[model samples]
Target chain A: MDYLEKEILVLGCGNILFGDDGFGSEVIQYLQKNYNVPSNVYVDDAGLSVRTILFNIVLSEKKPRKIIIVDAVDLGKPAGSTFHLDVDEMPEIKCDDFSMHQVPTSNLLKELKNFCKVDVKIIASQVQYIPEEVSLGLSNVMRDSIPSACEMILKEMSPL
Target chain B: MGKRIIIQPVSRIEGHAKVTIQLDDLGNVADTRVNVVELRGFEKFCIGRPVEELPRIVTSICGVCPWSHHLASAKANDAVFGVTIPPAGKKLRDLCNSIAYTEEHILHFFFLSGPDFVMGPDADYSVRNVIGIAQANPEIGKKVVRNRHLGTQMLDIISGKSIHPVTAVPGGFSKPLTQKERDKVLPMAEEVLEFAKFSIAFAKENIFPKYLDTVKVLGVFNSGFMGTVSEDGALNVYDGKLRLMKPDGSFTDFAYDSYTDFIAERVEEWSYLKFPYAKSWGEGFSMDVDNPKGIYRTNSLARINVADKMATPLAQKEFEEFRAKFGRPAQLTLLYHWARLIELLYNAEHAVELLNDPEITSRETRVPVTPRAARGVGCVEAPRGTLIHDYETDDKGLITNLNLIVGTTHNNAPINMSVNQAAKLLIKDGKYDQGILNRVEMAIRAYDPCLSCATHNLDGRLPVRIDIVDSEGILINTIQN
Candidate 1:
């Protein structure tokens, strides 16, 4: 319930151990270093445990008004291209695809928006490369886009 | 001509996998295989990194069970540095492990595999999930969610973060619990204990009775078992020698460092995962369900069967009832769930006992570690099974070599055999439906396999595609779920 005191919650979700897929966590690092956000706004680098955090938010006695999730995606677009997606625009995720580190998080986000009456927004960036192996650090494209992603997240927080 | 039925990306588990069942011209079960995709090059990635960073780095291996990797890595580092932690440090680490076990067991029982029994396996897929369970049994669902929250909160108080902990350092815990902190945790531990009691009783009265037949026959297979036990042969998840028990209940206890001498990993051409067998038994590896050779299981059922008794009183009573019903070396795969609850009860009680200890609040938690060139192996009975982290460090304490035999990997062969046994019995004459397919999945889920930990992944998306192919390797049908 203490977490519900925040009006705006910004979550950066990704595994930093995988190349380019770490865009969200990097964006969080950039934001924490460059911006001084209001006390009402809460920011977290959720990494692969984003589902558990979202689950807590959905089932808590009190809820935040708006939630923004920053993540890396395989959108087949040019790398580092950022887009805003409402909860309804997210694709349906089958239960079979659910894993602690996988896209079953999308299903939880969708449920929070539709059932829990919380506004959900996703800021997804196209990744240049996600290593088939356990390579760390971000690609140049994702590394460069961190500043822009931070700016976009700041602009979204202005209304709150 | 033989036909293959593929169920891609088994749902409600920790990772993605494809289950293929092959039928001969007579429409009888010919073979069944579970193919897993490996997240390549993890050991290579660790090369040249400072050994101290491994405990932190390994947390990213799987989000579901980071504590297992973190603690195992820390213990391995302790051996590499050649230092023994103070009694307080070791107790704190065990306390954290027990709390984590409580959270994971609660999640698995009520949220994950619980639906199979709570909502009934034959229910429509749409109504056989956490959400459906909540809708059907709101009161129980609410309690489950609340208790899980409490567990996380307790973890947050003990360790700075519940998701990826940084407290368990090489020599000892980085943080010490003050008396005030211990007082705060005691109440939460008590609450979790109450819930643990309720959970086992509820399952016994409501769920297990309805599925007794399934418990007796589904995915049943004969295999050896492996777990950690104290010198007294009491179940000890935190620190103990490895106990390898044969199907006849005979066993051998060995130091964890000599694990390679007793256990061997076998590679299969069809899968990226390695199948581990008990090589010390001197029997060649075989996956024959009725007469498995060198095959063994880990995880909850294995731990309960291998140990002579539980360390805690309540759990000891439950263990007695379990053995009385199933006998020694229980082969019923579904009994894993039953065993899991017993362990949950044990962990909750263990946590409370550790908290009440005077050593828990001692300031002498860690010792200084000196770098050395040595090989060390650290093993702990993770919530899922026995997790081992073996590391070879250079003179500068840099990791030169590393190998991790995670819980799921140890059960890889048995998982395959269980799948085959279930498929052969349930899909006779090629008669099957989604329910039958789910029953097949129940076999795998009972292990509570964390394939994501076995082979890691990111991106939050795993696309599943099932293909039905003829004997000539031509795709006859394609199904995407």
Candidate 2:
């Protein structure tokens, strides 16, 4: 990865209206407020449609050297447990669907990594729960892990 | 035993859905239902919240077309406050809607639905996607990517943010298009217009003609259509009364706020989505393909069918060409792709036209408003279909009651009917392959239904756990893959 290009992207992905699903977005807000982002790094909250960014990146000639996606997961770990996941580690997913939105995230990420030659990283926290209905806010465990999540990302963002 | 063929997690449209097809003893299709699994409970959750917040909150409903929800909700807020938005403000909203449509339609036509036509419907699944299109045609792929990026950038320049926009405020827009901003985006708008022109031409010459046979036969059905039109009956996506057209081409125009009077939603136990029918039609809603009662279609095909003519010259020409070939109320489901291209051209030209207007940069974009107890309904032609947002507010402007009819939800009945029809037409003798099932999916793709919610799971273990249950709700068989 070209650490000099500053072409690194840190994305926080999830829906803020879907309980613990908002953990990633909340972490992004925390990172923006507390951390001083370097010139080479661009941090954003891609929210529910991160697929748009990943899809564009895959199609475009110019691409970021590295990408770190922050999200919440329920991998049966204790709530708020943070860990790293490579693109290959993600579960297989369906084609990009509409139901007006496709979180075609996993598949798009795989494409970006294997074909686009980009270094992709996922820093996911164990979500307490994701609500089916429109509930807001993260669980206390997930919310408390925001700072730790940001730190983990910052570590990954270190000069390649 | 009658056979049930289930294609779970229908792919490449918006959110995921499932299609279950039933076959009778002779192996011909008996019935079919497309099951949509997630529910946002948007109305119940938003109740008691301040109405102004809806414009922002609704953006989270779907990331693909957040601008539609944002603007529609803002319009509803404007209605509740009873303020006439400034001309400049309305123009800004229209500008955003057109640009968003360009991005969305391009994504659908090239990447999602494009794979089927560009690569052939029976093409191997591995090479039928965005990558396939890019590898096959690199130049068009690059232009498509750059243009989509430009769309988001232009939105960010017009409003403060692009993804979850909060710029459309009650009574008017919060931001004004400065002269400098207008100059910056004008050429970008023209670039998109050039691509739009090329896109429709390419589809007509290369794509549509190749599939004319399939377009005629697959998923054909007779159904009414819905969309918005100006008082002059010209197609206007931003503002207009609702035009609900019958299968025979006769129609009724009703006020936006009076939607409840003409439209009624029917709930089915099997689907998370509701079937909205023409309550004003006097025939009760039914999914019968031979004679669908009160069932009407929305989205691209419906939008064009309901409109008398396109507002832009280029689109109007294409519209005339389309009508000459297919005739009015085109019942062929695949014609949706054709109709979608017309809207893309119209939106691109419309964007260029609006950017040229001097009033678009005027500073008086919004008016002040005080809260009062009132009912308001806002409607817009979302890329998916006609999106309607109705809100009833208390004296404090808190939402007391709310109902939302998303563009895709309007096609719920039509989708099931089309799936049933396609399954019946294609799967004779109960012989079906991945290609056959995917073709049935093509019927739903024409509508371009957006499910509006992400399918969540515990640590990516979705579509992995299978629970086999019997009619008595007993866990008789279990399969985990």
Candidate 3:
């Protein structure tokens, strides 16, 4: 069996151009540099158009047992905090006013859920710079939470 | 000597612009100038990012046609990685492109450009918007609103967001469609098809003829025409070789890979925008030419002229009749709204066909591969016109450079010329009265330019200032979105 055939895929999505909204891309870049994962594990930077991410979901030969997405989300938490949630836990995240891209993510997810069966996980980092100009470096708070984000995702993917 | 009149901040347009009309001392029109105030920097920002990330990064530049950016950027990345996706991915990408164009056309005609036609040009600006449409004919107006909303919803369902879709990645879509999702869109697609058919008849019989008699025609000279041309010669909006047809009826088709060779942009001192013209047409101003060859019009007019046939039946019939009436390759600039409507009808019908295809719901969503760093270029026909994105990546696949040629950029010269022509024509006899400003604005809005989409710097910031001075002389309520 191929390495990518075994482990699930994790997609990091956001607009790196829009200040903190780029948190997902930033984290993905970090993971690409640091993490040494199982052979089947695939991670991608999806950017602002999550709809296009659907193609990536389709191309995986072995259906990812699970999929994880890391992004900077505004769940009304303190500016530099991080939160993790799965498909079941998604409802708890208030979706009253989504960033314009959120509408597309919701729409893509709706369409994708019907065709594939993969556990969906989101690790969102809240930040002050939603669209404000920011640097590539992660905030201290989000930086600290990276380890936990990685740990939780790994645990979820691990076989008991 | 020529007199100049400046119309600053032309009213009822999406972006900022200033128009200058150059009139001979005898009050005859001499020349025209239009200055678009916005400046974009997409190339500078493309530097230092992975080529694969270009599609996802550039998608945020516009809220209207992110799908175009997504496809173009993805194509660019595909070039760098040297990956060719399956035919299904290409078809799905085309479907997404078609949806984007329809949604944008609906918004432009029904919401933005609809008022100028449905309501008289002389109608008060305040009452010439969607609200005005609702107030005038409640039922007809509701249909327009519903169509636009339904189109947006359909786009939202498929592409993730209606305006700027991110789901169109390089190689293929992020996932495949399901029977349930396909079912949700089937009925809506049918409704849109019905609405478009009704709208086309409405436009041809009732709307267009009414406006034709008094409609202000701008630009006496027929200039260069350019658009994406597929190998099959259908109006290739998703991706294709670009074709440029000169006023002399001679045409040249360049593979989008050879884009840099055929297209050359000239920078003017008066405006921040650059004028893109065909390279074979010669560089700089030509004196032997009676008409200004440097100024060329793009978008719908160019797309219609460059393609041999349209994919949809209704649009093809309309294209023939339109050419017969207005000459082969119609140049009546305001008639773009009509052409856009025709294309919308085609796109809606096509979207339905793609949605019904069982293969579109296939389980094989993505094929994994290794990333090889290289240069890539992607081009698609956007709602406005052909949009091209080019990227150069480092060994690790990070983008080192980027170049994006949006539809609006291609029309900078013609837009200026159109505004100038309208001002000169309407303002004849030296009286600042009656429909001059409206006519000028209508000319610019014809292209449906989205300036925000041109903003390229992913991390760039602008100094936005909002001033409210209190009695004590202190600035209050400083905020940003």
The iRMS of the candidates, in order, is 5.1, 6.2, 13.6
The candidate maximizing TM-score is: 1
Q: What shift in Å separates residue B316 of candidate 1 from its native position after superposition?
A: 1.0
- Which DockQ-derived CAPRI band holds candidate 3? incorrect
**Model 1: per-residue Cα lDDT over B196-222, one tens digit each:** 999999999999999999988889888
- Give residue A82's error in model 3 in angstroms: 20
Task: State the lDDT of candidate 2 residue by residue for A48-156, as single tens digits.
Answer: 7787877888788888899998987767899989999776665442122111222223367777777778998889898888887789999999988998999999998
Candidate 3 lDDT tens digits, B1-481: 3455555434334444556665566665566676664434456656776666667656666544677778888787777778787666776787777766766676677656777788867786546654465567666656655665566567657666553456766677775667787799789888888888887788788778887754536533467788877798778777778888887657888888788887887777887777787767775543112367645567887888777888777778877876777765667787787778778877887888788777777766555545666778888888777788777777887777777778888877777767666666677654443355566778888888755454322221211112222335454333221
**Candidate 3 regions off by >4 Å?**
A1-160, B1-5, B22-31, B39-41, B214-216, B283-290, B455-481
What lDDT does model 1 reach? 0.85
Better of 1 and 2 by TM-score: 1
Off by over 4 Å in 2: A1-6, A91-106, B453-481
Worst 10 residues of 2 chain A by lDDT: A94-103
Candidate 2 residue B417 Cα shift, in angstroms, is 0.7
Estimate the overall C-alpha local distance difference test score of candidate 2.
0.83
Q: What is the TM-score of chain B alone in each candidate?
A: 0.97, 0.95, 0.88
Looking at candidate 2 chain B, the ten consecutive residues that score lowest on lDDT are: B457-466
